[model samples]
Target: MPETGSGRRTLPTVADTEAFGRELAADLRPGDLVILDGPLGAGKTALTRGIAAGLGVQGRVSSPTFIIARQHRAGDHPGAIPMVHVDAYRLGGDLDELDALDLDTDLNHAVVVVEWGLGVVEHLTDRHLRIQLHREPESDVRTIVWEWIS
Candidate 1:
């Protein structure tokens, strides 16, 4: 069962993180927004890889830090869901700059996942699912916490 209040997941390994992502993906739908916040090396991308796998998206899923964003098209298959993965680590101080990214265009048919978007991107919509990852020091364990916002 999902943890009360926070819906937390204690992921001890890379595979566990991915599995959590996939489990979350099962409930995602078009136009849904998932915001992720965590320090470097917190397994955000690893978790996203699992989400993509759950969505039935083909191709490699990696951090798009350089490109800003990457779209994974859902192939012709049952239960396929498109994914728009974005890295907001490079954006400037202005939230207005996010408008240029054009993420809203396809959001209606895909799940938009934003990394490091704690403050800038949440204003895009009133309803969203936010995930935070915290890595344990001196250990590979990571804690994942998620909650719904409206």
Candidate 2:
């Protein structure tokens, strides 16, 4: 695993990547944004699953590609905030369409995680944690890079 700059971690397997997401969720606050960057099958959704677990969300966690956005409320975990998972793969050239979804309503009281969010929704906020996942050649391994930008 390779890392650039400071405070970044590389995960070796899908489970590790998800575990990292859980750890990250523990440190997230209301209004926190997470942008996931990766090609197809790079385990972006798997990471989000970890995030939901960390946030004390129950039930199953799946990619909301067809629905655009899905909200999950915190369960037994104390002080746990809501989790808003967004799949930007279907988004067109403009983000206005996303704005129309009323995602902003939960922006201040939930943690928003967007997959395929590289250029489309990167500007939604000034502060966010960017997670980039890449695959290793000829292996089931993946390299995950995390950066906190404010």
Per-candidate TM vs. native?
A: 0.93, 0.89
- RMSD after Cα superposition, model 2: 3.2
Model 2, 52-88: lDDT tens digits are 8888876688999999888888787687778999998
Residue ranges of candidate 2 with Cα displaced over 4 Å: 1-6
Clashing pairs in 1: none
Best by TM-score: 1
Best by lDDT: 1
Output the lDDT of residue 60, model 2.
Answer: 82
- Residue 79's C-alpha lDDT in candidate 1? 84
Q: List residue ranges in candidate 1 displaced over 4 A.
A: 1-5
lDDT of 1 by residue, 13-97 (tens): 9999999888888888888888899999999999999889988887899999999899999968998999999999998545667
Ten residues in a row with the worst lDDT in model 1?
1-10
